[model samples]
Target: MSEKKYSEKHEWVELNGDIATVGITKHATEQLGDIVFTEVPEKGKSFEAGGEAAVVESVKAASDVYSPIAGEVTESNDAIVGDPSLVNQDPEGNGWFFKIKVSDVNQISNLMNKSDYDKFVTESA
Candidate 1:
């Protein structure tokens, strides 16, 4: 029952009930160009919308990954940390960053759907 959504900052989330699996979008990874390292947030950590939740380092630059909605991190993807190339290889799939138990599911209404996000990306470019 998860519906995938995207944020303006180039992150995507798949919300299922109270849990959301989050990660950078494919466009984001392409922009980053060969990710070298990543730091997933610790479990049990709570963050507000727009707060820094993780970090990603690529050949271009190091960037902070922001939380698109308020939630408590329930799980972190250790596989991506062990092999960062997974991010570039599969940004929307196995490369997912973390899972959060959202505090308010309604907060996601502010984000974009695939069609809107595609237009937004195109227009922004």
Candidate 2:
């Protein structure tokens, strides 16, 4: 299994070769509260880094989910959309949003590692 990487915007990515799995972090889900709806990009759709690729709506608010690295969308987690609460229940695992065929692997260098993300979450508290 690949380790998780994080974006300052609160997204996370798990890279496994050229494919990357994406999701919102625990902090993000907690901030969003009870999730109600999720909009996932169609499989095979392409997007650039930092582009808006999905939308996640919670009881607290609706937020755009951005692409951490440019890539072609390979798969999406339909289970999470059908039951959005899974995002809050398991933000880092089964609650993953989508998978992407990485267009630029180097873009991941800009994201945070686990320790960095932990520090970020701590400092923001």
Q: Write the per-residue lDDT of candidate 1 for residues 1-125, one digit (tens) a residue.
A: 66789999999999999999999999999999999999999999999998999999998899999999899999999999999999999999999999999999998999999999999999999
Regions of model 2 farther than 4 Å from truth: none
Error of 2 at 13 (Å): 0.4
lDDT for 22 in candidate 2 is 96
- Model 2: how large is the Cα RMSD against the reference? 1.0
Cα lDDT, model 2, residue 55: 94
My TM-score estimates for the predictions, one after another, are 0.98, 0.95
lDDT of model 1 at residue 68? 93
lDDT by residue for model 2 (5-78), tens: 99988999999999999999999998899999999999999998889999999987889999998999999999
**Per-model CA lDDT versus the true structure:** 0.95, 0.93
> How far out, in Å, is residue 125 in model 1?
0.3
Candidate 2, lDDT over the whole model:
0.93
Q: Best lDDT goes to which candidate?
A: 1
